[model samples]
Target: MSEAVTHSVPSASTSPGLLASLDPLLREWLPRQRWFAGKGRPVTGFSLVSATEVLPLNSGLGLLHLLVRAHQPLVPTQSAPAYPADCYQLLLGVRETLPPRLAPALIGHPTQGPLAGLTVYEALHDPRPADVLLEALRERAHLGELRFERDMAQEIRSDLVPRLVTAEQSNSSLVYGDTFILKLLRRIVPGINPDLELPLALARAGCARVPAPAGWILADLPADSLGPGQGDPGDPYVLGVLQPFLQGASDGWDLALREMAKGEDFSGAARALGRATAEVHTALARALPEVTMGRAQMEVLAEGMTERLTAAVQTVPSLLPYAPGLRSAFDALADLAGEGQTWTAQRIHGDLHLGQCLRSPSGSWSLIDFEGEPSKPLAERRLPQPTARDVAGMLRSFDYAAHSLRAEGTQVSAVSGWADACRAAYCSGYAEAGGRDPRTDPVLLRAYETDKAIYEVVYEARHRPDWLPVPMAAVRRLALPEPS
Candidate 1:
């Protein structure tokens, strides 16, 4: 079973198209994937963008590099507009038979065509092919438009073995002997990927709160906005990014839980984390362009929040009682905008929460996953947003941690007091770190928190039904009448 399969390379001279044979397999497998965004909908069709063989087709093994477009129609609902087609990268390993070690990586068996009677599996799951991919990047190899480039200043050891990080969902990560990690993005959109763009900018600005890019993979595709009527055309889309792995780092969420279990005060750590966050924001603002939103634009932002709240109540009926209160928060924001208020906006972590951060053993915090809200368009994710949004997200995370303890029958008063102290210290640290105090602007912060809670309600209800109470409680708090 370990023997390599020998088959004619599918090229221009081949009879059946290589992509045509794999079409059915992809359509069947894509929707079943957890990383696939179109979970509730069926995949209607596919459009092959590119099919480049990383190695020669008839080499020791068959490795096909493919970028395919999956078409999924909107679910039958008036509020539901058609979701745009998404492009995904597939590194397919075709073998005559899979070894026991690779048995878990099986995609499916192709019954006919060029891949007839062969086992095709996701290559990243197999160390052999995964090493081959890393070698290609290390050697700066080029196959057609796909290029692998690395920072020459940073050393890349080819000897480091590749092992897949199994817990990832939206993307795949492989650690090379604990020295470096490569994050291969699954769903892709053309243009600059913020996951790569933001970190590079911050790293150059001397920001120590983010992992610097050691290497990356990119593909040049036809230029197009991926709109309804626009044809296929776009610039290079970042396929993956590599960075030095943080050794002995713990997930922020896990750290918080540990502290709660020990009954230890976490205000000190929370304050330091807040300072780190502000420093990164400062670096980003210095590196990127900053903008100011006028009253008109603020109103537009309020409308967007209202729309989200409206949709959320339809699914999470528990939100019905708090809808009016949440709507008032958005209204207050709009009223301020009408009074000729303006706010500064800049590049931020976009989606900031405890789970998205990592705390190292050295007592320092690093922010990861710069990719903004997954449901948003790529263009919107790149837009400058109010920094208050990030602050609000962290504040909500504090509440989530406390409520999780309460759900476990912990004393509500004790956990609530602890959360309140941490939240206040975090805000104080942000102000001391040369950032604006979130408390100074209650309207914007409250609105952002409401918007975030509304989103959480829908997400928790769908994914973790038991956790729905955590966000539902926030909705009620945010909806409460202000102190007169």
Candidate 2:
């Protein structure tokens, strides 16, 4: 069942004609994918950026590597201008008929197109195609405009078996032989991708709290395809990243829930996770340039937070009562900055939560997924931010775990106390690890935490109305004045 053999097929030319043929099928298929960002809008059409036939269709089983722009109608929002289209990296498998095993992966049989008579499905689900991808990465193959590169110092075995990770996620992943896991980003943008950039930086700094990338895949996109000022079109878009797999690791979220279920204290694990986070922060500071956010910068940051709150209150009217209280958090930060208060800023995991961590069988914690918030623009995600941003994210995650269990009908009256203890313990551990104590910077920490809660309120209100209460609870707590 392994299709690990390499083929010598000639690469296919990039053409709009090929995309014209697949347009109908793709329009029908794209919206249904979890990774497709334009979920509520209709796909107006598709424009091909690049296409390569990894394996020719004439070969009975074909694999096509495509980067297509999915055009969708704009939904106007008050805070930002709408983006008309999003680019996606697609690996399509073509066959005359699909086996029952791949039935779930089927996109559909194309009725009209170059693939008209064949059944087209997601290629990563087929091990043969997945194997081809890994082989390319191992060999550092250059097929058409796609570049498969690996660290010169690292050796990748070509025979590792590949299996698709079926988790409902924002991207696709393939685990190879329990040794390496490849994360393929579905939606793509120009410029340096932090998922690859951050890990490489951390590796150079000798930081063991994060996994180092072993290899990566990139695609050269056309200049016009990149939006205005994104970067030189010569900048390759990071499509996939391969890293060492933590074989026996347990997801931090799952581990926490288990401990809570048994009424056991999780403060110790939370504290260790905090220390690990501080270690990463310290390493990143040493490896990359850090900036000091002075009065001007802090004012701009506080202004952005205030604007976001204004927009969130408009969307979720339930936030109106707490709006004034929330406004105070941002205003206080701005007032302090007006008096010349300053803080350090550096690149951070823009969107951190318990779900982003893993605990090994031996109990060490490792952080993963540095891509930040998918909803944000690439430029914004890469900007330097205060370390408190990450600390606030982890603190909010503790509250989320407790509330999530309560939402599931767990009759635990001490849920709030459990969350509070973990939050305090985490900050204590962070200070012990030689990082500044977050508690001492109440103004900065409170501002970031309030900003995060506002984001969650808007997100939950739109996507999960029932779960809105989870963040709303935090809003209630955050809105109150800090105890002296």
Candidate 3:
């Protein structure tokens, strides 16, 4: 759909040494790459260790996968969530190996000729890698073989191969043509992912905001140190899962932003979004835990976000601003968290935001991206917390949409009006479904919004510093009472 063509590097390594010829490729590729979030910065190291053929030997031309491993460990020195050391594991996809006559010009490519010098092939033209990976997944396990525990359901499609669709730091998404979006977990941890879980539960409860699962992928990872009370013999980590890839969906984050950028009234849509939120939470309450607004859980969340902020800052020094006040803010907020007028605990969208939601073709909204913060460990993500956490996430997303588009050269006109409409629509919708009153909880909402804004400001600073102004704007807008 996007006019941007995909340029893939070889999957396996090309040679033991770092290929000097690839220096130009690496430099040019990194900045334009969607997967590598650290684009603006220079790469510290780029090397081609060796090559491995994933498919059968004579699989086809351009299938020579050179696992190009590059590392650039630079911490941000900013006043927000510090950046962390992130590794770029590129699966280079070359289309065709050139003739011996043109080998000199294309040798640096190993398989295909240079983009500008000679004729070449783009591996995406064939789409075999996505195919091989899917075949490996399906026959690897049967429908009823293993307990489908990761909160996802599965169904096989006989039509197409899995294509790599999305790339974030911790996960890579593979979409098999139209059938499914298989999220391959990177930097995995022991046990199931919460994103995979909450959606499945919502689906089971007949909630409509989620993209229902067809099935999922799990792995029996090595667990040398078994926890004292953990179950399962060898199923240590959840590798990934499969969900219906919305073939024609607009990013809710974008929709919200475009509205804000145009300054259109989004209050109606905002109410609808709110209604959907309440419905999902209600469904979650019915499906997961007995709603208990308790202190123990709040404390756990406080500790977790605090540590995440610290880690994010250490990795990217650009986010150093919020670090100094993170702990004290958490400590102060933790008290207000459990002592709310009335707290209701339920299974929540670990990572809820506009990006996590999709606008269906019919103008209906559906949430995706179940994985909470991609950086958080799996075990911590599975913990239950306030639904307000999810609420804060979506609100922050509204801010993100507005800011991201302003960066896209879109004119800023009635942007704030659209944002207001979205809020109205979402809130009205959410309140109707949850039996809550938006008018009655201004202070409570303000506090949660502030809490979330601080986190968002730090998060944006780390990932999209250009977009940091979105959350910063939110921080300026919120009416948080100073600690007495």
Arranged by TM-score with the best first, the candidates are 2, 1, 3
Q: Name the candidate, 1 or 3, with the larger lDDT value.
A: 1
RMSD of 2: 2.9
List TM-score per model, in order: 0.93, 0.96, 0.67
Candidate 3: where are CA atoms >4 Å away? Answer: 1-54, 57-126, 136-155, 161-170, 225-233, 261-263, 291-342, 403-413, 438-444, 460-466, 479-484
Q: Write the per-residue lDDT of candidate 2 for residues 11-120, one digit (tens) a residue.
A: 44354356777887788888889898888788888877778888887689999988888877777764232244688999999999999999999988767557778898
Cα lDDT listed for each candidate:
0.83, 0.87, 0.57
lDDT for 350 (candidate 3): 74
Kindly list the per-residue Cα lDDT of model 3 for residues 1-484, writing each as its tens digit.
Answer: 1121222334333334324545666666555555455555667765442344444223344343333435555544433112233323343444335445434323234223232332322233235656644654554532211123322135565577655454354567777877678775543344667767787788788887887766565534234212223434564445467777887888766676666655666676677778777777788889987656446766765676567667666665645654555455566556766675346666777777777777777878787777777555456567666676677667666666765666666887766445545555666678788887553555445446656776666667656777777666665455334445
By descending lDDT, how would the candidates be arranged?
A: 2, 1, 3
Candidate 2, residue 114: lDDT: 71
TM-score of 3: 0.67
Give me the candidate number with maximum TM-score: 2
Which ranges of candidate 1 are over 4 A from the true structure? 1-16, 76-83, 225-234, 408-414
TM-score of model 1 vs. true structure: 0.93
Residue 289 C-alpha lDDT in model 1: 99
Q: RMSD of each candidate?
A: 4.4, 2.9, 8.4
